[model samples]
Target: MVTTLLTPVGDAPWSTEEFESRLRAVPEERYHDRHAFNIRMHSGALSQAELRCWIANRFHYQRHLPVKDALITAKLPTPALRRMWLRRIQDHDGLEEGEGGIERWLRLGEAAGLDRETLLRGDTVLPGVRLAVDGYVNFCRLRPPLEAVAASLTELSAPDLIRTRVAAFERHYPWIDPDGLAYFRSRVPQSRRDGAEALRLVLSWAYTRKDQERAVAALRFACDVLWSLLDAVAHEHCPEGS
Candidate 1:
């Protein structure tokens, strides 16, 4: 009979060292070094067409932010926690149309020469992109509250990425209009604040073997989701150097 290998569950409540170690490893192993969008952005190698494609495709990701936030908010049991999380949705969606993160991203898209309709259609999304984002929302919905919070640890690596991205935009996309880069610039501080809060919530709440295991699993899944999204973007957009 064929049998699957039984990997260590790591489910028991973890010490602070165990928790942090798991957290650190997720990004190191799974973050988006392989994503073409990031590779191009970091290397200052993206053409205007590549930049435009990145903006156009990223619209789907921005549009889904509030939907996932709503799913998370629905699961929170306390009014205080719900209220705290509500701000997260508002930050992405804003009080009106043509505002907030999505709008800012749209501005970036337009600057990259993509139209609003094409950006919004979602038809152009690469297959792996949907899988990664769907996995993220699913992980958030299925995991315990502490574990779900832990999954947001993608933010831990995000601030550094945001800085690099901002510099890359300035250096490489000089003709893309500085105002259009506001979305990337805006996210750096937001990522830091959100990452810190999510880390605090996870570290403070996950105090048992089962909880630690679940937290680590959630973080691993989150990293996979992020890495997969970039992989799809790279595969579909860059295509091994065309």
Candidate 2:
């Protein structure tokens, strides 16, 4: 089975640099690229119906992204930290409809022919999808600040995947309106901004060896949460061996 906890209470201890190496390892091994959904999405192999399911199911994820950030923001005691992190919620939620990442994802679903009712009601969402996302939120809410920030490190690999996804959609799924891919487009700048800040936060605050290990563990768990969700979606929605 894939490793879940980074270092439990008593495993080998990691130094700060070792922790960084482990941190890098988490995404390298467990990032969404390893996921079957990503492989199909990036290759444009999914049918339109599969694409619709992707949008509908992933809409749940988009809804929770900001909420997770808000949870983290609520935890920060300092105004400066809170102020810096609060932008994430705004970026995802946006000022109004037809804006923000969530809106863009909805457009993608519409372009894929998903009805608003089914999409909004989340009637088609897989149980594992909700579990993985909830796991992420709970981790942020319950973990130490360093670990929570480290968990956000999944954003590090997002830009590349976004680019690949857009390219695939443009090439293979021309029937899809270009506007629907906005979810990936909007994520580019926001992911970079949030990821850079999160990386710096984890590196700076995780001073001790044990703290660094915890931070790495946090990141690995976050990656698993995301990767596993995509896996669940793919298994449930995608056709045989897809």
Best lDDT goes to which candidate?
2
Give lDDT per model, in order.
0.76, 0.80
lDDT of 1 at 141: 74
Model 1, residue 218: C-alpha shift (Å): 1.2
Compared with the true structure, the alpha-carbon lDDT of candidate 2 equals 0.80
Worst 10 residues of 2 by lDDT: 233-242
The count of residue-pair clashes in candidate 1 stands at: 4
- List residue ranges in candidate 2 displaced over 4 A: 1-18, 237-242
Predicted model with the maximum TM-score: 2
lDDT of 2 by residue, 132-196 (tens): 88888888888877888889998888888788878888999998888777788888888888888
Clashing pairs in 2: none
TM-score of 1: 0.87
